[model samples]
Target: MDNSSSSNITSSPTELDLDNLRAIKVLGKGAMGTVFLAHHASTDPSALSPFALKVVDKSLSFAADADRRARWEISVLSRFRLHDPLHPFLPSLLGSSETADILCWAVPYCPGGDLNVLRHRQNDSVFSPAVIRFYLAEIILALEHLHGLGIVYRDLKPENILIQQSGHVTLTDFDLSRSLTPKKTVDPLPVCSDPETDFVPSRTFTRFVCPRKKKSVTNQKGLRKAKSARVSPVSRRNPGSFYERSNSFVGTEEYVSPEVVRGDGHEFSVDWWALGVLCYEMLYGKTPFRGKNRKDTFKRILMMQPEFMGKPNALTDLIGKLLEKDPTRRLGYRRGASEIKEHEFFRGLRWDLLTEVVRPPFLPSKDETELTEEVKKGGIDIREYFDKLKAPSSPLWSPSLDEQRHNVSLTEF
Candidate 1:
């Protein structure tokens, strides 16, 4: 816990008093808690600005873990708020508070929505190379800053990459992230002088596209019915290590690294593996190593290589290097993000000037930035909202819905 960076944070009030805060709408609901579109109750309700408040209801069965994660996220955000000068791409803690039955923290709202939703809005449900490059560069810089602080962002996916009002990307969800102490180690692989000739292979690899299956009426109905009944996968407990390797099998199923799935110790390299999966998903429409279910997905992650659909290119080459099974041999393992920054795919990228870039791929509509008229009429107490939802007659706490709510996926929020 270093507080040296505390002096540098001046953009927003460092401490938010929950008594003055009001919830506008439910932004999302996840495993840890719910995120609400909130603002200071005294502030103009019609104002364009509002922040997101993540609240953990402590009366729930899993309140302890959720409380710990909420606090951890606050700590992580505090560090970024005090130390990181680049606020455009990282979340800053506007305020945080706790009560006997609740814990809550607020962050600047990202109106552009998460990358997953934005990608779905695209015509082909995928981004062009240029858009991917822009977004990836911002993400790389954010990861670089986190690594510099000795933190490992184990969760890196489209869902966590949020778009700012300026349309640039900002990463969210630090609950799954862990702080690690980096040990000095020698690079096992030598740096190549000629990146162009050293990395590119002569043979072009072709990937087969799996055909989409048509769903029968009964199958479609079953899927629709199952949507509300699906349960979240079991969460992995923290290994509670600081300087040494972490052995916890934590991460989303599709984006998890090979080492994580094998239950072998993991460090910062896991993020690079996830970056490869994200890049592949951005290029094509889905994850490369996905299988039928969780078991099959994990097995493929350990034994299968990422399948690419196009001919050999700098982007594909970068993906291949990042997806390397050996953590040490991975593209960013040794030098961290510096190695990936120098890759041929990002050869001409001006990493230093990333924040100055104007006109990002998409700008959020005005409706996203302002509270709806209907929402403006009501001022809901954050704690009372959850308490009411958990009451006996409430739909959220009903016997049948209790299991579903308890097992809700983390992505829903």
Candidate 2:
């Protein structure tokens, strides 16, 4: 064979360069992708370690805007690890590249797996109050980072929350997220010259007011120059409105914010809504608002009837504020995250002291390395591992109509 002019291909079949990396094993399979575990040989070879590399089929990028999505994901992940300065909690983006139609991005492997897995592995055992507070505090810190950068994390669930050995929680999956600047108000409402002539008493506001909280005033005159600075003066609704009524739905049915369910364009409040749902799940083993069908679930959300069974008063109060059907009355929006932190559940927590607090309440299984070793020695049985971590059965676990729509018929994928 003429070596230089040979038409022959390499003997190995597209094997990843295990020289700079090592022992690539499939972590999970998805519709269009698979994740792998490989050591970082590109860095200091002497360093003992490996990393998680998420690889996606390039053909999956055949859509018109696939490249744009890929680039956006890469951009977002690159900065994910450094979001929180004081108590930064995110996966470090090691490196990324493309070969053929495969897109590969690497991050530090989370040994403890995710919250979903933990919840399943330890069924019926609720996270300690300290752990819950720490995890939620980390979540809020992460949200503050993304929100500050104008990004909206539309998807918030246990599956997307990864727990590191250090007990820090990192939010993942940016597919449904987008940058949000306050939507510019359209056609400002005409300013009133004479209040008595132009003022029309708001019927909607009547039901929400507390007569005893204020004076015995029938028609509270002299409306302030700005009723609610947070709300747009030109929006169809007045300031301090709960949820803007509209008709559109975007988000997981169980976790979708009220405004989003109603089709009104959502704002930061949506994050708060999802956070409430997460908080509910944290305290209780399941979501507060759930139903046998999609329609039923929607009804429950509208009713905002989440049962507070066997819940601590502090925890119930937190959930109550979060699950408020009216967004305006929600916990965080009223007094900001401060109120949430101040709740009795988090009484002794010191935000400023987090930096000095070297360790977290939970840690990854110490046998993680042994598990990996077994995989290398024989073969990695990821399916069996995850099967053992399946979520517990609950009456609320029925697949909704929308869930059925996207449900995979077979488990092969």
The parts of candidate 1 lying over 4 Å away from their true place are 1-13, 185-243, 368-370, 392-413
lDDT of 1 by residue, 365-398 (tens): 7664336674557767877788788876875432
The prediction achieving the highest TM-score against the true structure is 1
Candidate with the greatest lDDT versus the true structure: 1
Q: What is the C-alpha lDDT of each candidate?
A: 0.72, 0.55
Candidate 2, residues 167-229, lDDT tens digits: the string is 667776564566554443323223212222323222231121112222223322322222344
Write out the backbone clash pairs for model 2. Answer: 20-41, 58-101, 246-262, 247-263, 248-262, 248-263
Candidate 2 segments whose C-alpha is farther than 4 A from its true place: 1-23, 30-32, 41-47, 60-69, 80-87, 183-232, 235-250, 334-336, 368-413
